[model samples]
Target: MQFDFSARQLITRLIFWLSVSSFVGYLIGHVWAAMTLVSVSLLIWHYLHLNKLVTWLWNSKSLSPPMAEGGWGRIYDGLYHLIRKHRNKQKALNERIRRFRDGAEALPDAALVLSNDLTILWGNKKAQNLIGIQWPGDVGQRIDNLIRFPEFAKYLEAGNFESPCNVPSPLDAEKQLELRMMAYGSDQVLFLARDISKVHRLEEMRRDFVANVSHELKTPLTVVRGYVEMIQLAENDFSPQWLKAFSTIEGQVSRMDRLVEQLLVLSKVEVNSDVENSDIVNMPEMLGQLIEDSQWLNVDKKHEITFDIAPDIAMLGSDTELKSACSNLLSNAIGYTPENGKIHVSWQYDGERAKFSVTDNGPGIKAVDVARLTERFYRVDKSRSRDTGGSGLGLAIVKHVVSHHHGELVIKSDWGKGSEFSIYFPNEVISSLKN
Candidate 1:
């Protein structure tokens, strides 16, 4: 329903106008009359041509013509405004998407977005680092192909959205991690990975420590009970030699008692509770008391004791606990050292930290055994430890106390030279007590 005018028709109209003007001049005998006829005809032709040009431009498919002047034109202009608005909105949406991608790339934990078919859609920086994935190459790859864990593959196939499944690191892996998968959207899954090896190791250590403690306590109690029963049953028929044996049995019983007491103290310190009810213990005074106690305990052996305490050194801890810890260290030293050998107790402030050290001229620990010396019931010479009435829990208790106070315990010894046990308390504790 459209029409177009040709250039030939426009040329014919010009020729007709010139001819009409010549005819009018011959009839009317006036040049003005001929010019007026020529002007009117040309005006009519130009108006008709203008209409045709406008229709052709509007009907053309290749170019968008300007709107007409009326109600239809207003509607066309409204549509144009709506199209521009949509374009602006789309541009804003794209910008937000770019920003979101940048943020996801910067995250530290390994994060992956998976499609419904268990294919990886996208992965972050940490994912690439942890999983050894190449960016463009990894997208659209099946997750099961990359992870290669049977349990995780089964977990994804199970379609359980309520609970997450853990995927452990692969064998011979560099970084150890635990991956958890959860359904995030209608057709998507989110995979999160975290490093939990340290936590796992800590849990294992706790279990081992508990088992060792139980075993240690059970052995001593069994021995002590057996000796008590023997002494009670043969009391009436006991001679002087039997009486001496009874005294030895009593010594073993006393050693067991000390072991039980130390175990209780260690248990209390390790419990999940605040240890705030402590006193400002004077180190010099406590050392003096320990020396006196050691002298009495070593009366028969006659071991030499030495003290080199720094003046005015103090510590913040339970008076009974600290005294017990120090006493155990000194007692072990006195019990192990040969007669007339030296046992030295010294105190000094290294910078702001306080160091309490006990050095003994005893048979030193072997290089290999030093690592496990602080473990409960771990004795280098089991027979010697039993004979000297050592509970084998002394160093273990010292280690627990030092850890509880956020401190460090260091043991230095050569194969031939004596061992030095140093307990370092944090400087903050000392400064707080001073203030």
Candidate 2:
């Protein structure tokens, strides 16, 4: 339709030029002069068409493409159709982007789109509320400048997103926020912030509740144990049956007392969120003490126990926690091994981390129960565990202790062969003693 105007104008101009040329020829009485004027006018029309094409090419952002007639018209029309297709595609893409942003805005957690340079590009409404971002007002501002959290900046630069970092929520001091980053789309990063304040508070409540109950039961347990021991000491005052009953009572009470003490220690370990004054642990000395305790524990079974300990192995953590973890593993080995069976304990450093392992030639645990071995009250052989006076919280206590020290507990076993329980303290928590 646009080219039709060019066509009509061309035809009108050609006719007008021919009539003028004819008039000039008539006035001059020369046919050659009129023919030359007509040719020049035709050449002028071609120049105007070429100029329009050049202008269209130069101003590529123009709303509409230029139009022409004759040979140039086909070229212009082809380019115009191509531009229309491109514009349609662009419109569809823009719509999809808009929909994606709307979906992101609806998310509950704060979400931010950041440039490779850590500049704030875009963010959702929740992000605005949480991070106090004013959208377009802070568009080009550096994200670190706004958040000012040292750990977050460190994590961003570290580029190790395997774990998230926790920090206080920007909106409320009481709230805790977990922040993680996902890298995408040409060096850009997607940051997500979740409020974990509720979870934090619940964990705190659980710790406090466990601690309070353990503390309350301790005094009564001590009195009961004292009376039970006194009764055992008194002889020839009752029938043999009554003495046997008293013995059972004494054993049961002692078991309960031990459980209570462990519960108290476990609660204390759980409640401590950070380490304090923990760098003075003597690993070799600690292992030696554990060997002595294992020997005493195996006196009834008379099992053969061995220790291969590495010297200069020290770690930074609560001494009580370390002792509990190592002692529990050794106790499990000594309890399960048959009389005269061999048990081996090793303390070694493998460059990256220090490992404390207890391996025994006892009845191997089933594969089904291996995963839950660390769970409180879980037992592969419940009857055997009870017969051996296991309170069923040893492994659970060990797990908490290891985790408190930022270490790992790994269990390996082959059916009918043996079980090996190992604690690996990461290098971050391990250092050599000065001596």
Candidate 3:
């Protein structure tokens, strides 16, 4: 322990020195010579201690202070305390890092840290087992080089993490992985790979069940609808109440037939990958035909429909699916919009992306309903939907088609005002007539 070097103590030391010099001078018969001798001896003692402190500070690793007396001793002790405090803080920090790494290693999902350049910085053991990222050996390797799937590479380069990509594991043919990338800490990426094989199998089973049942129901539904129509044609053979009942049956059977057909289409689109079959779609011509069909469907409502189609605005996708999606949009607008309501459609490419948008002055959807419009069998107003003859699968089919073509369905609506639905296709899929 070191005590404070107070001014009073310093004054006492000076007085002692003066008295001793005066006594020595009286004996030596030279006062100046005695004082100079005392001063030089004190300077030499301080210099030796200062040298020791400097040497210890510059070269020694020990946290203990150097042995000294007076002011130098206090300084050494202060430095030792500072060094010890810093060491404790550093040790605690190191321990926390160890705990975090241990916890990450115990995770079920494969986790990896990647630099902005997508180089592997660190990975958990699960990453090694699942994606074959070797410990220490694969560090500093480009992640794209390791997971060489073209889709994965594209997804990484796109810088979009709102959705994850599902791909098969490289090591096992049957295993499925859902990979997601997240941005964290100073331009680093947290890449996660989850084993979604069970989930994928279940989804496949659901799709297969829907597809098989829809196929089986299609024939029976057709037969029922035909018999109902035949009974409706012979209206005089039945009483007025029976005829009304038969008409209701006919309408319901028709709606059921539409629902079954949509289910089949939806299942088909879901089963096929985004790029399963590729072709250049003549979007302008397709929209023109759909507009004509919408006009026929709009005869009763008399909605004022118009379109501005860019001449050569084509895209690379499945033509049948695209047409179906476009038809759904137009049909919905005609069915829902009030009489004489304005519906405008446009197709344009702004170099970066191609867009198809439909704007309508319909009974606009509420904010809460807009988000779930694409879900199968979702209805904002069930009574209104039923009156309009909607099967509640149109928007769902549209969403799947857009997603299958690597596009997005963007819906914007203002309650009691109007709504706009747009599909945006990235430039990679944007094509043109090769004239």
TM-score of 2: 0.80
The residue-by-residue lDDT of candidate 1 on 325-389, one tens digit each, is 78878888888877777878888887779988889878888989999988888888989988887
Model 3 over residues 187-277: C-alpha lDDT tens digits?
Answer: 9999999999999999999999999999999999889888888888888899999998988888888888888889999898787766554
- Candidate 2 residue lDDT tens string, 28-63: 897678868788878997898888878887866685
The lDDT ranking, best first, is 3, 2, 1
- For residue 347, give model 3's deviation from the true position in Å: 2.4
Candidate 3, residue 378: how far the Cα is off, in Å: 1.3
Instruction: Score residue 55 of candidate 3 by CA lDDT.
Output: 83
By TM-score, highest first, what's the ranking? 3, 2, 1
- Cα displacement (angstroms), candidate 3, residue 28, comes to 6.6
Evaluated at residue 332, the lDDT of candidate 1 is 83
